[model samples]
Target: MATFTTAFPRGFAIEVLDVYSGPPRIAFKFRHWGYMEGPFKGHPPHGQRVELFGVCIFHVDEDMKVDKSEYFYERGNFLAGFLSCPVMRGN
Candidate 1:
């Protein structure tokens, strides 16, 4: 129940690994999922460049805005949402 935002940096895109059924014991837990199979199906895993790790919680408003009324970074694991963040390197 805390204000949250996409972890992706400006203009940065994340190569999605997979977005499966939620309620993970790690940290971020969503009651439902958006992305699915078929057009989303693949060999081993399935998902697109997940730059923005969209999460569902009572932190921010439905639009993902700050709301002091209901803001809670459960377990203090904000970074966990970005665990699959794209790895980048430049010259």
Candidate 2:
């Protein structure tokens, strides 16, 4: 896991309504954060072993309402970089 600082300047909680994978917009339902953390090992076309820096999912409703989101940042802006980090990404 990629260790990162926990001090994010702009703290927010979000809910991801969907994530678009591949060519078509394949509608997906709520996926638990626990299920997404990866020490995921596979050959990605990007051609490198990249550990997931945690997940940051943002969801906005049809009425433009923010549901919930979380930013488990690895390399992030400002404050978090300065503060201590608790969690990390899997390798």
Candidate 3:
């Protein structure tokens, strides 16, 4: 998280879209917006804008400490936006 924050020093924002809590478990859906100001995934900052949405699920132990976490997001969308790739046409 700190690495990403440092990479996008110009702007970075995360908006929580939804959250669900259950005993020992929690889930969060969020949207992330960032502007490239430094290197990311071997690509130097292009001053491009990137937006993506993802979900994070967390499992907590009896002691209320996070034991596990998972994240899901679309790699293609992020790469396309960040690299300014041409849109693909469906067959």
lDDT for each of the candidates? 0.29, 0.32, 0.76
What's the CA error at residue 61 for candidate 1, in Å? 19
Candidates, ranked, lDDT:
3, 2, 1
Task: Assess every candidate by TM-score.
Answer: 0.20, 0.23, 0.66
lDDT of 1 by residue, 1-91 (tens): 1111222222233333343333322123232122211121112212323323333323345555545322222542433333332331111
Candidate 1, residue 54: lDDT: 37
Our model 1 lands, by Cα RMSD against the true structure, at 13.6
Worst window of 10 by summed lDDT in candidate 2: 3-12
Q: Give the top-scoring candidate (TM-score).
A: 3
Model 2 RMSD, rounded to 1 decimal: 14.2
- For lDDT, candidate 1 versus 2, the one ahead is 2
For candidate 3, what is the TM-score?
A: 0.66
Which candidate do you rate higher for TM-score, 2 or 3?
3
Full-model lDDT, candidate 2: 0.32
Point out the higher-scoring one by TM-score: 1 or 2: 2
Question: How well does model 3 score by local distance difference test?
Answer: 0.76
